[model samples]
Target: MAGTYSVNTNLIAKLAELRITEKDIHACKLPAYEQSGNLVQAEDDMFGRTQLMTPATLTSWQNLKKAAQDEGITLLLVSAFRSIDYQCELIAAKLERGQKLSDILSVNAIPGFSEHHTGRALDINTPDCEPLSEAFEETPAFTWLEANASRYEFGLSFPRDNEFGISYEPWHWACRLLD
Candidate 1:
């Protein structure tokens, strides 16, 4: 199945051309967020918000979801693979509503810097939790993830006060499938 997933040539070229490091990848700068690739929606046998992930990412996520379910924790996907274009449109829509880009950037990641562009980040919530909010941390699903997500190679991509300066999002999780 891994063969079905090819590396994002554009992202590699962008990274190579820009010489971005790990720290740069997390930066809010425009150069850091430039990426493009093919995507596939994965909803078969899954629930909640439909997700788009690299085929391999979807496989790993399925494994992780099963683990959560075995523990009686049903995680709901709130968001997933988002194209840089879509993200930009979202920001544009916000701007149209009179929201400042700086304020939007504080909450929503600036395009390419968003993990959702990589098709590996997941915004998970429980039936009782609020999606994309810190209140999710109080849910049993969050507790289960905190204790066991890493076992599936999934980890919280950002925590409170993370260097990226984005707001705390307890529902966000990422699969570092590449490394």
Candidate 2:
């Protein structure tokens, strides 16, 4: 994975701007992900925002969604591909809102380190639940995903006590790249 993605100077500067040090990067348990260059538009999210993902991820997500639907569950996309710049903006917004940097980093990955940059990660939800809340774990959509998402090559990225040190995110899943 190290050889797969090289962090550029701009990203380094951005991390510095966010007050993320080399020690912070080294402490992160998750691997850095390169932003996908080959991405296609996926289905519009519940908010009607267009999402993008790698072609294989899009196909797998569609299959997973269809299978869930067949089982009387509905999966809605909340987020997909996100650029390093977008990641920076998210962190900056949180910082401006007075959130501690450490708290922010625990949830949102530093720019260039987010799995969302890979275009294979998805934040999913079902109707009647908060989009990114831990309560999703109790929903039928999450139960269906836990039992069946692997059939489409998707798996939860961060679970309870995950080594990534990220918070438990029941709504986040990522597709395995066949390539």
Q: State TM-scores per candidate.
A: 0.76, 0.92
Among all windows of 10 consecutive residues in model 1, the one with the lowest summed lDDT is 1-10
> Which residue segments of model 2 deviate by more than 4 Å?
1-6
Across residues 18-134, which tens digit of lDDT does each residue of candidate 2 receive?
888877877777787788898999989999999999999999999999999999999999999999899999999999999999999877888888889999999999999999999
Best by the TM-score measure: 2
Q: Measure candidate 1: CA RMSD.
A: 7.2
Clashing pairs counted in every model: 1, 0
Error (Å) of candidate 2 at residue 9 is 3.3
lDDT of each: 0.69, 0.89
Q: Give the clashing residue pairs of candidate 2, or none.
A: none
lDDT of 1 by residue, 26-52 (tens): 444322432426457777322555668
- Cα-based lDDT at residue 131, candidate 2: 94
Query: How many Å off is the CA of 147 in candidate 2?
Result: 0.9
Q: Candidate 1 — which residues are off by over 4 angstroms?
A: 1-38, 44-49
